[model samples]
Target: MAAAQGIYTWDSRSSSYSEIYARVRSWWELLPDGSNPLFVLVREFEATGVTAGSFAVLAEQFSRRSGTAQAVRCDLELAKVQEYPAPWDGLHVCTVTVQVVDESNNSRNAYAAPVTVMINCPPAVTAPTGRCAMVGFYATAERIVY
Candidate 1:
């Protein structure tokens, strides 16, 4: 079926209208192809000491934690960090793009789905630590693939 469609009118009293409407919606909601294999990783850290200069360090730490042997890792790398207007109170939100070898890192394993991993880094109290503490993180490859 074609992916795009014209607007349709609906009649609440007719059952056929509901069926046709649902069919049309399904076409618009088709999943994406596997050409683009990147997904977004959102990490929330304490805002007390996080700064623009610390993004690189935080990204590296995240990459290391995510590519462990237990977790499926297929040349996963940090693509980039998203830009936002400002940080929330007591919380800093960082969105980054992570790239894997395949949709579910299947190139390196037989798993059919992406593994979810949550990793926390030590807090950066002084200037020497050079790392930001990660309070929470969330990422799922299936959603991005869809």
Candidate 2:
């Protein structure tokens, strides 16, 4: 979907057959009303040319094929913009979550390896160039400690 939406995808692997598959199934429940928008539809894909292609390319193709694919339904709120305080005022907070039940695909109670997640959001982000660049002056004290 990132590729489809012209977003950045961090897919780096040898080219073989497409083995990367991703999906975002979400729902929203207003704190009070308990009503929110739905995904309308969601789907996961296993691309053939995925091995060599960047996630951007694969995601684009996946988005194109989103209509004719099977999707999974979810019961959690996603990307719900809630108001924050002061410095974070105008900027809304977008949150994504997942539930790992003892199901077939995601059933692992052990803690050896959790799960690597990929979130579906817009491409534009506040990415930092240097180490810990996204961190603000709050870390100045720690920096001085060094």
- Backbone clashes for every candidate come to 0, 3
TM-score of each: 0.21, 0.16
Predicted candidate 1 versus true structure: per-residue lDDT over 1-146, tens digit per residue: 01110111122223243353344333321113422122221111111112235434433333111111222321123222122321222223333333222111122312122332222223422212443333323333332211
Candidate 2: regions farther than 4 A off: 1-9, 14-84, 98-146
Candidate 1 similarity to native, TM-score: 0.21
| Model 2 worst lDDT window (10 residues) | 131-140
Clashing pairs in 2: 4-60, 15-52, 18-48
Q: Candidate 2, 123: how far from true, in Å?
A: 20
Model 1 worst lDDT run, 10 consecutive residues: 1-10
